[model samples]
Target: MNLKKHILALTLLVSNFIFSQNTYVFLGSYNLDKSAESIQVYQLNTKNGNLNKITGVKNIINPSYLTVSPNGKYIYACTDTKTPNAGSVSSFEFNPENKTLTFLNKQTSGGENPVYVSVHKNGKWLVNANYTEGSVSVHPLLENGTIDSTAQNFQYTDGSVHKERQTRSHVHSAIFSPDFDYLFLPDLGADKIRCYQFDEKQKKPLTEAKVAFTKTNLEAGPRHFTFHPNQKFGYCIEEMAGSISVYKYKNGTLQKIQRINTHSDEIKEGFASSDIHISPDGKFLYASNRGKENNIAIFAIDKKGLLKNVGYQSTLGDHPRIFALDETGKFLIATNVNSGNVIVFQRNPKTGLLKKTGNEIQMENVSCVQIKKIKP
Candidate 1:
């Protein structure tokens, strides 16, 4: 082949590859007695693994936990508040072309302090966790991504030994199984993960499972849980004990397998866990530890879904409340609430360990981090 022709062909191939890959990061701020709530958007350069703020700063109202749509065209956040009993979930239509978001609609969360929200796999129903009210609510979503007014709310009164944290059942998070057949609600105050048969078409739970399983340690305060991609195994992070418990789930039944501590043996007291997540490839798991131990615990996932501690890495900031992995699994962003910054880390694919990239973005009371791929 002629030299000129070969060069042209290579240029075309490179351009096509670059155009097919894109990513963006959206951060949720706590507001923390501030004037306005805000969410920051950033465009990620896939080639160099660098991130640049693209949407400037869009202000909302106390957006605590944010979730992106399955199609990546919309972003939803929980607008948590206590004044006048106004708590709602807001939706934003994302413009991937310009990396901007447009406010779509807002709907009441049916309870106070809606700290967490999740969309079912079918994208037909939205579930919320009301921390202060200790309840779970389900809202139906319209085709335009707006929520319906009618909601189904359920409150729990169970409690465990942890009088301070679990005095009243506090629903922390609600997640659906991969098949959208069952809904799992983690209650910090009850120290239990309740299972419900979810009916997406009806937008409500069919009936309570005969057996509702509780965690091994009462007052451990299970806050969040993440399931494996295959849907056979799951892991839950305990906020009070700073530990993780592995479980084998099948046919709506969860059997405890193992529990591992997030802190070192030498260190004692003043440690709490915030969030837990599994990699897209289902090969590794990561959990965040706050309060004195500002680090991420990395674990390797075996074929049997057992967890083996790989290692731990400092988040390079204080209070790593929440962290998320980029779609490509190349970068991880940890939101440091106390430090008022979001620290970026590069993930080693083979070892599943995080290395600080030395690129930190400053923000106030950052609580949650969510990422989506942008369109060209």
Candidate 2:
């Protein structure tokens, strides 16, 4: 081999090795003051399941939820939460090499209390769900990591059985299907999962699907929706009912296959289930419960796309509003919103079990957790 060519090849190998050893973790929280830091960054040691603090960004109010762009160069967050008619979505440019986020721009969320934000696979569209106003907003994403003005907005006013919690529509989450051709929005107050067809090429990419929506149990209150890795099944977590509904998905249509309770039989009232996620290998599913049980329910996935309850793991703190599994499925991070702690658990891939690693961080009101493995 030539001298210069050999040296260049060796440098590339070393760079790849370094990138494989670490992943980046982004945290979002509710800030007491507008000037306080609402977002934090950490470097995760993939080998040992430990996190090292990187930096924190301030001046953005209530960045309670965050999503990274497909290319991992940009982050979009729902901001100004709980502020009447002042909800907004902000964009930031992320530099993975330095583990920093630079604020780019912000746009109105079209409603109040924007709770969830999701980016399409093509990285050209962004969507958010407003809880208080029960609306969904869509925007065009520019190549420079800044978000354009809202291109479309939809509002709903229907309510369900619950007198207090379901008095009106409460759109909690906006999630895209695995193929990026459909969007499923879980409405907590309406007890419905609204379906939409998406085409990035169109001026208005979001439209109602043929089957408009799927109704859940009378007072289920679906909060978050997620698709299985196989793309044939979908899961929705019910906040009020404390149950997880399994659905068969096809062509943007959802058919309820199963509805199972997420809480134990000992507890009856105050059911508040929060988030749901499947392992990368598609062998297990995990859901978080907040209200009386601060634990995660683990289920084993059968070949027919059904869930069998395996066991429950304590979150090691209270109010586990959100949790995320690392890309490699080696670690799971759970954020306790009420207890103000972040706990890391070592995952057993074969058995789908989680064990506490004694690795935890303290941060008040931490509500969201996201992990991304960046490549050089």
Candidate 3:
């Protein structure tokens, strides 16, 4: 009986290890020269939030933002640049067998300084936000995961209240609505969340939606936007203004609900807020505050769609550029751009709080963490 008990326990442990999912972490980064590798891949252990380096992709310059397709067969990156006609978007085939990326093709983004890129759930179109030239563009994606060409584009010329930072239109992020019916763009320089009707089934896809655009408070400088899992509430993290603006969302239209500051009262100077994302369950929201207070501001979302400050936690590094939660929402990885490290934190699902796991992945200027789960 004793031998049988030990055998049963050992067999169960091996079965669990084989059945567990392997998560692939793709780190986007800034590459100064062509020789320096920019994109790094790692396998994150689910048992503990530890990252093991897998491989690195070189020759791509400054992939500031990355998005994986729904099918997990393609990876898209936005090349961060300022020179006119130089900014671009690149697509690659994600090989699951060896965990490597193969160059597919590249297309010119509508304008300079392409900062963010998001893909349609159907995998038909890839949208990019141009910061320096204040424009947005959409490209047709191939069935085999290669990019074809730019299909449609829009340019925003207006500037906002900030004299230096808001000198002209800066398109920060372009994200598809929950149902993939509309495309919402947050323009930092224009202080607006621009809306457009998107139809990937058409010959030429992007067009104006029922409501062309929604305006935030003047000088708000909306940088990033995230939708609730329920699809009724929307949140925008303002960059220059350092606040989160809540809205009631439906059919590509956003109606203002409430607004709250992400920084504490003591944080008066050097306010720069970067990214925002809600938990998978939609019970909590997280926003990164850069500049003076380098920490992530946590908030709880009540049933009424209102936000209450839960707490703030240190990022253990400078300039938390972007962060993402795992598939299970059990762990979070934050990329600190200035401090050149990516830190992992264990999350409590019940309380929606983060505790650093003390496992750090040292890198060079990582800007984004895109998580993909590998299924057996």
Candidate 4:
């Protein structure tokens, strides 16, 4: 009986090890030269939030933002290879068997300084937001995952309150609604969230919605927008004001439900909140504050889809521009662009708080972080 008990315990341990999922960490950076390593991949150990370097690639200049394909076989990045004023979007193929990324092809991003890129769920269309030129660029995806040339482009010339920053439209991020019926452009310079109807079947996929745009608070500088997993609520991070606007989402329309400050009231000026993301379970929300705070503000979601301030965690570095949570919501990785460090934190599922795991890596000018779980 003693031997049988020992064998049962050993079998259970082996089964658990075999069933664990493999998590991959992808980082995009703004490297000055094309020869230096700009995009790096790592394998993350979920048990302790440690990252093991898999492979690093170069030859692409300033691949600042990255997004994985829905099927997890490719990655799309916003970069500028030739001239800073004429940015481009590049594609790469990921091999899970050997854990490597190979450069595919790139195309012009329709405007200058493409800041964000996202792929459709069906993997047929790609969209990017141009920051400097204030435009939206659309591309068709070839069967082999390469991006075709730009098919359509929309330019925005309106401005808002700030004399310098908001003098013209600055399209910061392009995000698709949960149902994929519409695309939302958070224009930092325009102080508005522009809505467009998306039809994948058509060559020109974006059309002006009935409600062309929704006005945000003057000088809010909306940076990034994300929807809750429940798909009933959405959140936008206001960069200039350092606040979040919660909304009721339906049929590509956003009705503001509540607005909350991302930082402590006592700590007032120099607010530059960069990115916002919610837990996969829809119980918690995390937003990164860059300029003065350099910390992540944590919030808990109530039954009414409202947010309550829970706590804050220092990112262990400076200028936390972007951070991402793993699919399982167990680990949150924060990347600092100026300090050039990546820190991983283990999250508590019940309390929605993050604790540093003492696992970190250093890379210069790292602007984006993306986590994916590759299937076997």
Question: Judged by TM-score, which candidate is best?
Answer: 4
Tens-digit lDDT string for candidate 1 (1-376): 6999999999997885664356888888777454444787877665555678766335567888899887777788898554348788988887867656788888888778888888877677888888877888888878898878746888888788875777788888988877778888888888888888886666355457766655558777888988998999989998888888999988777889889887766668776899999888899999999888899999999998988888999988889988998777878889998898888888888999998887888988888898777565
Q: Whole-model lDDT for model 1 versus the true structure?
A: 0.81
What TM-score would you give candidate 4 relative to the actual structure?
Answer: 0.96
Tens digits of per-residue lDDT, candidate 4, 1-376, equal: 9999999999987765543436789999988777788999988887777788888888888899999998888999998823566799999999867878999999999888999999999999999999999999999999898999988899999999899889999999999999888999999999999999999889899999999999999989999999999999999999999999999999999999999999878777878999999999999999999977899999999978899999999999999999999998999999999999999999999999999999999999999999998776
Candidate 4, which segments miss by more than 4 Å at Cα? 1-15, 18-21, 81-83
Q: What is the alpha-carbon lDDT of model 4 when measured against the actual structure?
A: 0.92
The per-residue C-alpha lDDT of model 2 at residue 307 equals 95
Best by lDDT: 4
lDDT of 4 at 242: 95
Please estimate how well model 3 matches the true structure, expressed as its whole-model Cα lDDT.
0.87
- The parts of candidate 1 lying over 4 Å away from their true place are 2-21, 32-37, 56-59, 82-84, 203-206, 374-376
Q: What pairs collide in candidate 2?
A: none
Q: How far is candidate 1 from the true structure (C-alpha RMSD, Å)?
A: 2.3
Off by over 4 Å in 2: 1-17
Query: Who is ahead in lDDT, 1 or 2?
Result: 2
